[model samples]
Target chain A: MSLFMDLNLPFTADKKRLKTLLETAAHLGFSTVAINYFHEGQSKGKKEIPKPTPLAQLVDELPIVQGKSRPIKVLNRLTILVSDASHFRHNAAEYRAYDILAVQPTTEKLFHAACMTFDVDIICITVTERLPFFFKRAPINGARERGVMFEVCYAAAIRDSTMRRYTLTNTLALVERNKGKNIIVSSGTDKPLELRGPYDITNLAQLFGMSEVEAKDGVSSNCRSVLLHAETRKTACGIIYTVKTPNDSQPKDGPPLAKKQKTSAS
Target chain B: MVRVKSRYLLCEIHVSDPSKLLLLEDRAITAAVKDAVTSAHGDYGAAQCSIGFSVKYVNAHTGILFLRCPKSSYRLIWSALPFITSVERKGRRISCFLSCLHVGGTIRTCQKFLIRYNTQQLHRMLPKCKTQEEKDQVRRAILSSSTYMLKGKEHKEERD
Candidate 1:
């Protein structure tokens, strides 16, 4: 299979713990991992969204994947816990900083909106508590059509049996409706031990109603597609992310710095 | 006559404490696996799990075991193995993981595959030795094993 990825690892203030978590993820053969910063968008719209630390600052050196010789790829992701319809700011500038943007809609109405229209790479399904509402077909279909994936974190399940019930219940509901399409399973973990291997997650996905192929895809190809979608979300169709940097142009005939910067600013 | 179909799972239990491996009884492993299945998949899985499930063998030294389950529900049981975080006995918990080495229609096939797979693993580890002494030791061990196998084969041929 292609590179396996765990797209969500909870961001913590403790650097050592985060480093160990990253090391554990790398050791488990996750080629790509995202440091997830959870933001509850409930208060009077805080202008300054928390910024993700650069990967260099987070860890001195990325560990090589267990089987792959290449070092792990780390990305930043912002997961907005959207409880109200107005909580999600449309075209928020803060979102541009993150490589992946996700929204965890707590209510059915917000969930429907997130599934149908949110310009997010992933929609986090609640695993900490029983789903507040049933997953409807229309919204899930919309999400599938738009290439937005739903995320189910398994760390909660390993921690508490109650959360495990909720994780299974919510996963089953989503699977029953979507039939295992566009689902990404991640370890929303802070500790190193909570992270599981890719094959382990695939087997666990079978418990979530996915067949072998779909479960395998959920961890590998589907996450790749999500990353691609995020790339496109940043750039215009994965090309022209920023007006061609001056160095990319033939230096002899390159555009002026001011003009290039202006074009990139747009 | 209809054949009664079943699947046998060859598994290795990975535990931090080797001493605790002695406490892993068939019943306790069964309970742990069943509890994981019930928690993950609920009553339907539990009902399916109770059918024709048996522990064929347990190797305490190697921490290997063969679990037999009805062919139809093998995946259900197999999937639940990853959820088994540990095994407990006498109020002492041994943190362990169940890794399925092979699954086959018969225990004989599983046993054959495990033997071959383990040999392959040994071969793979030979090159990863850090020192020349270790490399020489592994090479000598492999040569001795192969010679031993050749002698056994000759003896078997003579008997035949």
Candidate 2:
């Protein structure tokens, strides 16, 4: 019964607002919470992008709440408008630390690479009402044109299905096939209010043909694993040595320098 | 040097105490060079890949080894039923398939082997070993030792 909450809403400049949201999520019995930041003005085509709040600042404010609570998993949700393969490669490298980077691939090769090389755990193929401006000028009334459009449409449908089965069958298959790679399913919703609960998300999985176990795991376990990885990276910063104990100092037959230190200390 | 097509071997070693099996280090095996070659090149062509004595039994408690061979040189390794001892292969790339079996040993020994080698890759390489006797010994050593436990099959009955 793992619980999760997504904080993809427009965060108020007020610290109190953020605290209230966290507290509300905690009260709602969520074991994890994901924080998504949108590149402001991109939604409206405005040139000015809103500055994102730092993770450290958010962590600092988290302790302000009063009671003992389950650890709320935090993740950064990034949406990229994919125009080229190089763009995805560059962005993936830059945001490698992020838990999930949602991208809508224009081609099957691009999508495959996104999942493979870039380590994209969740790929959100955007379902747009109108095709991108670039596709408009292409020649029509031919089989090639229809084939291109058909592939694009099929890809979108597959992506939607992927989002639903991410936790269940697809993720398991990916894990089985790739061994160490991780795959997570995300709604890729822009608005916080639009974000679905864990149960609803699971139900959506069933609607998309995911089994009950698969649906639950997609939203809970898969997301949990991703969030934990992000948390590990965050906390592991500058702390390389985890083994800290007097007995772990060094074995008697270790390096000469280590033995010398042991002798001197003794 | 036998020119054999690429094949895989899937060997499942079941042990009593898997944890104990995990303790066997690379140095524990007298044949380090053979083990290294087997791990790197696999049992395809002239390259004879095999898991050394440092095999870590992850499911030490349950005493089960789940092996998957995608492709391998020798298919007879599977017939040999090497759940306890060591696997020695003569050629390159083996066949790929899955094998599940119970053996001896603790969860610790299996863990040690897992730590030293790539468990998944090694798991895929088990069935490519040379003889049923060698395979059986490896399986017996893995299953009987007190090292690790088979992850999902902890409560299942042990094979004789």
Candidate 3:
């Protein structure tokens, strides 16, 4: 079975609370979790992107994941709230620090741009409030083609009944547009009590209009693909360069292998 | 004559505070579960869960409970179980969640599964016992529990 992962856990300044959240997540059987740092764009003035906190400072000893003897893996994620086209900077140097990049676009135009052109792993759908615009087919398909996953957060639903209605409504709309493909459900939770087990999240996904297989994928395989998508964003076309160890007696060549291949093709 | 079928759900409630488990009552759990089903699936789920649905057993000390519902609508209730964040008691809510351990068609099968689960838990606890007396006591408990279960089954067969 694929290891369960929660791709979004809202970052908090309180070290104690964050430690408890990580412990609870591991106890609940999530093998991987990401601490999400959110930055909302301003229209007028320049805003500095928030830096991710180092994982070592949060917890001294990582807790072992339940049923998996190994320790839980923690990742840093940055989510930029893009209200306007100018909000998101393309290939910003600051974004490389995060393991995953996500954007929450408030407008249809920004949403389309994020889907087709933005270098992001996940697009967070608005769940706490009424959706300002309808989800169109073009952007949804474009996102799927580009391997960008739509994220539906359930923590808001757990907090209030009104948010619950809005969450289900927006999720159903997204499911309709995408036919339940390339979507992931994550608990953007701030507290340890808000975290649910992976199977529970799967059941909750079914209530969001996904089939059994799709709901299972929402918590397991879909999240794995998103991690891979984020990894590829860090490399050149998903290719990595490795340095030979000193133990190897082979002499270095004049040109790199990739450049040599390109020159030969030309 | 045809017999009606039902599904038994064995669930364990996890509370942030262990003392809050005592505040959980059968009626409160049933109401919370029904409310969750209504909100999650609307009136259709509420209606489906209302029929032949009941809290069959509750053990506050162990935090284990059994829920019974019709075979067809059991999925509706099982899915709704996760949405039950807490049970309200005396104007205050005790925040908790239920983790389902097993689902069985017959209560007997559920009881058997619970026994096996408890035995496994005891074995796991055996290694943590600091004193030899404590270890011996746990071993005795495990053996007695199994024999008691077998004796009860034999008595039931004789009566039948």
Candidate 4:
């Protein structure tokens, strides 16, 4: 199963720290990393404006390959705090990252804008306090209305274990209702250290009412689809081809590698 | 590929004189149209009304609005459009028509309405229009300038 690690390093986190985190993720079998970066001065109330760091530099400098493994993909997390179409366009112009993980209570106008500007794959609705409002404004039906995939971050599920069932049930109902449109369920955790792997995430989905197949798809296939659609990764289809010398090639003379042939031989 | 089943209450109001349409006040009818649409579909905030549903066309002057509903809930809501105020058959199947005053209604009036009125009214009432012709009409109406204005108002309230 493919793994994705959310790299929520602080703005102050230097390149060295980021390198260490990427190394750790690569070592642990993560195929993709989603880096969440927001302007600090906007929130910190600092008048002394720091020059905007080019996001492209981070993408270019990120250690995507370790040793001889396939290069790990890096995606910038463009979380729209409140759905602002202009802000999304501005961000798209500035960063031009592969994908956006937008938070909602945003208008369909803005959602469409982000998708058009950045070619967004997954629009994550941050249903923290505004669960009802979030569902109302950007209803599962509305996502279908706008012809876009809608993702729900189970904040309450991750925060309070007791609320997990309810969140899961409601989210599942939403997913079932909008089955054709893409629905992604995530734990919306910011700290990379606290994230859960695909298997654990699958287990959580199962506990919350997703069938084994559904849970597996949600964590592995669904998550991959989201990350791949983001700006960081160019291709979502995880197809890799390896070329080998004639001597290194496995023998095609071995009965076409079918299990039936092996069993018959045995 | 997204199908929504939306329910709207179309009240004829039984005005004997058709020429007295001016005295009827388009706003009142529009308000009723808005109320029926909201009650049947759910509150989508005025701003979202235009873009959220399959509103083919609306002629507030003649009190006619054409809408689409997803197939799943079409039976529950669409049939009830003509008889919204009647309690005996509030959620039962019934014949409905679009006001000729509005464009495109004459051609697609017989189209079925799908309604699934749950506690969440807005999402439930949307119709799943399968045919490309029906889907295109709904998309155009929902994304029109008037509907976007309505959605913008609802959005303002959320921000406030």
Candidate 5:
């Protein structure tokens, strides 16, 4: 069985609260969780993105996951909100430090661009209010083809009734356009009490118009795919370059003379 | 008479302030559950739940309550139960959560199960009681609670 994962846990500076959040997440049986550090558009003069706390520095001992004897896996994720095209600097060096990259597009044009062209691994779907623009099919299909998942957050819904309506309506619209494919559901909550169990999240997805299998995928398989896609994004289409260590004693020129001809023969 | 299948839900209410539990009533629970269903699932779910929804029992001291709904729509009610963040009573807001313990077909079965569950919880907490007096107190509490239920069951059998 695929282990359950919640890809977004809002970052909090308070150490005590953050520890409680992780402990609650572990008790809720999430095998993996990502601490989401958000950076709004750099409309402000300061362009500094907050750095993620290392796992060891964040918690002395990781809590064991419920029903899974092993400790939970923690990851760092960066979600950048794009309002204007210029807000996202091309190849922003600061983004490379995180494990996953995500973008929240505010405008219809930016949404299209983020889905079709952005190099990010995840696209966040706004859930606190009614979607400003209709989710068009072209960009959504492009995103699906590119292996980028659309994220639907449920924490806001849990907090307020009005937001619940917006969350369900916006997600249903997206589901209608995409036929329940390439979607992920996460709790965008900073409070430990606000976070629901992974199985609870799966059931909650049904309120957003997803079928049972699709809802299950929203919590498990699709998030797995997004993590793998983030890996490929770090490398050149899954290729990596390695530097030779000083201990390397192989021939600097070429292979041995005896094997040189055979190398050329191939 | 046509027998309508029913699902009995066993749940515990967790309140930040246990004193506020005194305000909980059967009507308040039903109303809170309706509001939760309406908000989480919308009007359609609320309407479905209204057909066969009733609060069977509430023990404010223990925070355990029983709800019985039409079997087919019990799941709809169950999912929305978690969304109830608080219950209102006489202008006082009691922040709380409804954590489900079990679901059964009859109240008798639920009672039997609750006894077993409480005794097991006692066993789990026995190792945590540091002082000898506390350990013995817990032991007496466990034995008395279990025997109380078993004695009640024996009387019911004799009366039947």
Candidate 6:
């Protein structure tokens, strides 16, 4: 069985509240969760990107996921709100600290650019407002081919009824374009109460226009794929590095110590 | 003979404060569920929820409840259960969430599942007992509960 994962828990400053959020997520049977830090690049003043808190400083002992014998895995994610093409810096040093990178494109052109060229794991579909531009087929297909997953967060829908309409509308539009391929449903929530169980999310995904199997994959297998894609984005085409021993240069080597293996599984 | 088929949803209510569970009422949960269904599925879901829908059981002490709905529209109700964030009592909201544990065709099957679930929970809690008295208390509680259930089952069989 595929492990359930909720990849976008909004980063909160309060350690107590963050702990509760992590505990709640673990109780809901999420095997892995990512703490998402939002950075809006459109705003002026040259603000610095926020650094992720070390996992040790946040929680002393990680809560074990319910029904799963192991403790929950926490990862840091950076979501850059891209209004213009230049907003998303290509291969920035700051992004290396994060386990996953995502972009929320404000305009259609930026969306196209994000899908086709950006080296990111996730493209967040705007759920707070109506989608301004239609999701063009070319960019979506390109993203799918490149193994970039599209994310639809359900936190906004839980908070307000108006946003719920927008969430459903935008999610349906996305589903219509993507046909439920390479889509993930994550809870972009700051509060612990807003987190829903993985099965609950799967049921809700069906309401968002995904088939039952596709809905299940949205919370499980597809999220795993996104994690794998993020792994590839961090590496040089998923290359294996081998350390060259000094004695090997003296022609006293047995099988050259280690051979470099290139595995582009992602 | 045509028989009415319905789905029983076994759900556990998880609250941030356990004391607030006393404020929960069947009517409030039903209202909250109805409100969530209306918002989630719109007017169509509301119509489906109103027909053959009822809260079959509510155990405030255990924070468990059972909801019955027509088999055709149970998914609408099951889907809406997650959106219910609270149950309002006397204009005050008790923040909570409903986690659906199982969906059964009949209430009897749901009850059997609940018994098994509770036993599993008891096994998990057994290791946490620090003192011998506490461990004995848990063992006695488990034995008494299951024996009482068996006695009731035997009486029902005798009646048949």
Report the C-alpha displacement of residue A238, candidate 1, in angstroms. Answer: 3.5
All candidates' TM-scores?
A: 0.75, 0.36, 0.83, 0.40, 0.76, 0.87
The best-first sequence of candidates by DockQ reads: 6, 3, 1, 5, 2, 4
What would the per-residue lDDT of candidate 6 be over residues B85-156, giving only the tens digit for each residue?
Answer: 989999999999888878899999999889877765665567668999989988987887798779978999
Instruction: For candidate 5, list the clashing residue pairs, or say none.
Output: none
CAPRI classification of candidate 2: incorrect
* Greater-TM-score candidate between 2 and 4: 4
What lDDT does candidate 4 reach at residue B105? 26
Give the TM-score (vs. native) of candidate 1: 0.75
lDDT of 1 by residue, A138-206 (tens): 999999999999999988888767887788888998999999989999988887656677777888898
Per-residue C-alpha lDDT of model 5 across residues A96-200, encoded as one tens digit per residue: 889999999999999999998899999999998788899999999999999999999988887887887788899999999999999999988887667776666
Q: Could you tell me the TM-score of chain B in model 2?
A: 0.25
Q: Sort all candidates by lDDT, best to worst.
A: 6, 3, 5, 1, 4, 2
- lDDT of model 2, residue A88: 53
Scanning candidate 6 chain A in windows of ten residues, the lowest lDDT window is A257-266
- Model-by-model lDDT, in order? 0.83, 0.39, 0.89, 0.44, 0.86, 0.89
CAPRI-style quality class for the chain A–B interface of candidate 5: incorrect
| Fnat of candidates, each listed | 0.17, 0.00, 0.23, 0.00, 0.07, 0.33
Off by over 4 Å in 4: A1-24, A39-68, A83-92, A95-103, A106-119, A134-147, A154-156, A159-173, A190-192, A227-266, B1-160
* Native-to-model Cα distance after best TM-score fit, residue A249 in candidate 6, in Å: 24
Candidate 5 residue-wise lDDT, B1-160, digit = tens: 9789999998877675668887798888898999998876688998998898999999998788999999999878887876888888877778877766678999989998888877766765676689999999999989998898889989999999
As for candidate 3, its clashing pairs are none
Best model number under TM-score: 6
Residue B111 in candidate 2 has what lDDT?
Answer: 41
Model 6 bad stretches (over 4 Å): A42-44, A241-266, B123-160
Query: Residues A1-266, candidate 3, lDDT per residue (tens digit)?
Result: 57999999999999888988998888677899999999998878888998887888788988777655688999999999999898888889899889999999998889999999999999999999998899899988999999999999988888778998899999999998899999999999888878888877887888889998999899899999999999888888889834457996686777788988999999
Per-residue error (Å), model 2, residue A164: 13
Candidate 2 structure lDDT: 0.39
Residue ranges of candidate 2 with Cα displaced over 4 Å: A3-23, A39-52, A55-68, A90-100, A127-196, A228-266, B1-160
